[model samples]
Target: MQQGPEGGSKHMYMEVSRQIGRMAAKGARVLEFRCVVSELYIALRTILIASVTSLRCRLQKRMLTKLLNALDAAAELSTTDRLDEVIHNMVEVGKSIGSNSSVEELLAQQNLLVRMLKKMNRLLEEEEACKASCALCSIEFLERIARYVPSSTVPIWKHMKASIINFLAWSDSRVSEHACWLVTTIIDGDWVKQWSENSLEKKKFWKNFFALLQADSLQAQRLLEEMFTFPGSVTLLFSVTDDFNVESTVAKHLCCAIRHKQLNNSNLFPLVSYFSEMVCVLKDNSENESFLCTLRRLVKAFCLATSDDQSPYFSVRNNFALTIGAVDLLRQIDELAKSGIEIYKRKRDFDNGINGGNVNPASGLKQCLVRLIANLTCEHHGNCDLARKLGAVPILLESTKLDCCNLFMTQWAIFALRSMMKEDSGCRDIISSMKPTSDVRLD
Candidate 1:
């Protein structure tokens, strides 16, 4: 295959590749196919890495894929997740293979799997066209190693982490989503967390994660609902709350709070309050809408894990945050009306430090809080119901009347309420039945 600068060789290469895949899938001599493919890859590693010919790079990709199918067949791929799917797939493989294959044989295959994943991870950087497939398959291979493998702890996946910022922006949703899961596997790994040498690797993963979350991985929006539930991840994002990279990360963390196990309300309080004090941290580039789209998932997992939460959103001591947004906005509205526009304008600025611009008084704070609530509750009727149950409906209704210094307070309220109606009929009924004032009811 490497000798091909020849014409029409492309079609032959593709056909041979397809046949190999078919054979591998059928388990027809898969072990021998894996061995031959491994030899071919080793022979052409230099060219494949250089991608001397785009066609050759593609052929190499197919070869790697064929290799993956063989491994999965050897290990079985259908079941991975409660160990979270992929890992569970591996745990089951480890269990079943113990019955069928000798310990030495499985260990040998495991070593080879790690080497392949590392090689593919490196090749992924150079192979854009097949980057997604390369990454997806590589991650699966690594997950197959049972938790005890020392190689599993190494941050061999580190090279791929740097590429994630770009992956999150790709049009291909799987690329970004798989990238997320890859980083997640790294952080959640027992070795990565337990080892002292890899502490830097763990921190780097968190930094990358929040950075992606802050930018809002649009293509991987579905992945976010399943993201950052790992404690190490949550703590790292919190420890750096003041850092700008974490701007939108806390919101992602907060929304996932429902998935947390019996969190020490004592520990959770400081974490929640710390973010509330810096609520202005979230940036516009951060779209809080991503996870609410999976409201059913959140609601399903909602009471499944109980935490002593102070609000529908966060559990904090003194419990001031339930109406946290409400209090701030009402105070601003009163002060803006009473203190006068110029004074209020002179008093505040958004994302501003000392001697900042005379930006619109509502530009950052008002817009942020309203938009945060709206997006947080958007497609999340359980949250909307929680808000109403906590008396937020009347507050949100009162908020609608405020001009918000031309920040569209009414429009935002309408958006928030409309989003609430989108997912649940019961929440919609409760909202509709309420008459905020003689002039305006939520209907």
Candidate 2:
């Protein structure tokens, strides 16, 4: 048959993919285990390469059917080593397909995904050494599927949640980590928003999700510990707590409390306690950049949480803030500011050869601290008073005049000054003294 260049390329790819599939199928039929595994790996690799080269070129329906048949045949093999090899190969292929395939294309091959999930579930039910390997691959494959076809695959994930959670309690950290990702992805991804349309269902899902988060399993706690070390993790936690639109409920409530001139939400105490624990850890390991990153995220999350005080739930927001211990947060911020200033000064002295100490300047951390202070005190008289009492006003004023201060730092310093001046004349006096000739209006 005559063909154009595009048609010729498609024909060539289909023929090659079929040939590879045939070779794999033949090897499996003849009980040549090694050959079957090798051919399957090669076939999947070839498909992956082709997909990457041409995203529009999907697996031909015939080729996909052959591959699925090969997977089914391999799953029936009684040998553990063979099963593990097959499952591992399946994982690679699934990952490649998930990454390259469009949502519509993935939906068309839903049967393939379902079969893989069923096979993995069967293996997990068998109390064998290979279960962990099988479970890991399956969890990862499912996660990939969710990422690619989130809307269509939501039901499959919801059905598999219990099993996935079981893997969270597995002794292996890697297994637990994958399970954590799967759970979080299912809840925090775009699909959850669509799935939770019914208010009752949304309430039930959140309640159950929180229960899962608060599970007593050691593995669960390990996941939380791992997440706590990262910055955006708090925002993720907050998304599940209140509305997905706001990053952190605790942060939002704290901001609301400041605005309403009240701090009394009992429900927020646990979050405050959690922050306090994080602060203690931060103090013990101030040199760790990861901890600093977490702090930066935490600060930003709080800023976002408090940014929206105009919500209809203003009274509830105030209650949340009231319980969150303003004094405790102020102390944490003060300590962070002091440490940041020390680092900033050390870097300055070293640069000028005035001190022999070598320090890595953490400008980002300092900026986060200043931004957080500004957010906390922005329109809240109570926070302004608390900040001044904690000596934040002087620190903020100093930050504005420092040679190292960037535009961001200057802007936040100006914000903090504005807030502090709202209820304290001393803050206005300090600013006026700093710039006597300039027209500095505290009002």
Candidate 3:
């Protein structure tokens, strides 16, 4: 084993050469052997590269070190939503890494790491073990790997987006919110520049992007509210109502109505304005098909929540009014019947909000009367004032719809209509003189 003059293992080269010859002599060209050979070559290559003193190696080392630092910071940062910065840094470092690794290789590594970390985090979460540690590890891992490819990698972006989105759907609302926040920050990055140059187009893209998040948060609104806190996050919370993906339920209905009421009472109405503009954008015909659907759902939820609202804040009340400017939104269940949408459902869930028992017979019956008036007049008039001023119509209509049946809801809708309609002479006259056109046929 004569050593080479390069202060290297000269005998090692001889041994390697002899082994290759022996393998060749034995016709060891099987697929398994080839794979082993390939791996060996890669290991040798890495070792050689590490041993060399080159600018590229120096740069690679620096990027790797920076990425590791970012991971560490992500795990330890006490500040809020700081994962954005860590992920951003990781992206820069990942780009440098990608200069060496193929796009496919980088994507593969990123995906593997994300999968592993998610599994680990879930286990930790389930065991009620070191929640903070699990969160830190997961965030750091994602932040580091998320940077391997830019958003311009559409295929990779789709995968990464789904990975993050799945996290948003997690049972732990805090995890989901953090995941959503990460997604928003990443999409806001320069990678979207490839999608469009015009700033308006860019903004529109974000509107749709955020729309996805809006829908997701609504599914777990209460938990989401507790876990994540961003500057305009409150607006995002209400915006979820616009998401059609969320199935309307008694629970969600209550949540939306109650949350808005609470927000208004707490003097957080300025944040409501943040949603007003997006709601308008969502109303745009040119927006994506999904966006339009989401917008419709959001408006429906907003309508349901505000219908029974009694917020005294001028600004909060103004937002409620602004949301109505969209013609389509203004038409649902009629503006006049603000309290009408939930009459039927309300009868069922009244106990949840009221005295832990169903609404008392008197109030319950009045609610039913109110609903009838709101439904018919509001649908026809497109005016909340009609319902407000001539509330008498609601009682009469409920009596008729209920067919003298003892059903409380029917009576409530009618009474509500009469009470709201009586306030305005114009409404009273309209109600009195109104004839049921063919369009008004009883359903």
Model 3 scores a C-alpha lDDT of: 0.43
Q: Give the per-residue Cα lDDT of candidate 3 at 378.
A: 41
lDDT of 1 by residue, 1-443 (tens): 44543333444445556767877788878687886576545445544533444543344344444555544443333222211333333344434333444444444444444554444443444434343444454445444333334444344334334344444444456665666665445444343234223356445545555555666664233344433443343444455434533533454345455454333233444444544443333233122323211221222222222222344334221344523533344344444535555423413323244586423423344444445456556555556665556555555565566442434556766776677677657657877786635664342
- TM-scores, all candidates, are 0.39, 0.40, 0.33
- Candidate 3 C-alpha lDDT tens digits along 79-172: 4344454445545654555456545545544544443344333333332332443454454445545655665556545445544544544556
What is the lDDT, from 0 to 100, of the residue 71 in candidate 3? 50
* lDDT minimum window of 10 residues, candidate 3: 360-369
In model 2, where do residues sit more than 4 Å from their true spots?
Answer: 1-122, 125-270, 308-362, 402-405, 425-443
Model 3: how far is 369 from its true place, Å? 8.5
Instruction: For candidate 2, write residues 290-313 as lDDT tens digits.
Output: 454444445544454455666332
User: Quick one: best TM-score, which candidate?
Assistant: 2
Error of 1 at 122 (Å): 2.7
Model 1: what TM-score?
Answer: 0.39
> After superposing candidate 1, which stretches have Cα over 4 Å from the reference?
1-105, 108-117, 129-132, 146-173, 182-224, 227-233, 240-246, 249-267, 276-443
The CA lDDT of each predicted structure is 0.45, 0.53, 0.43
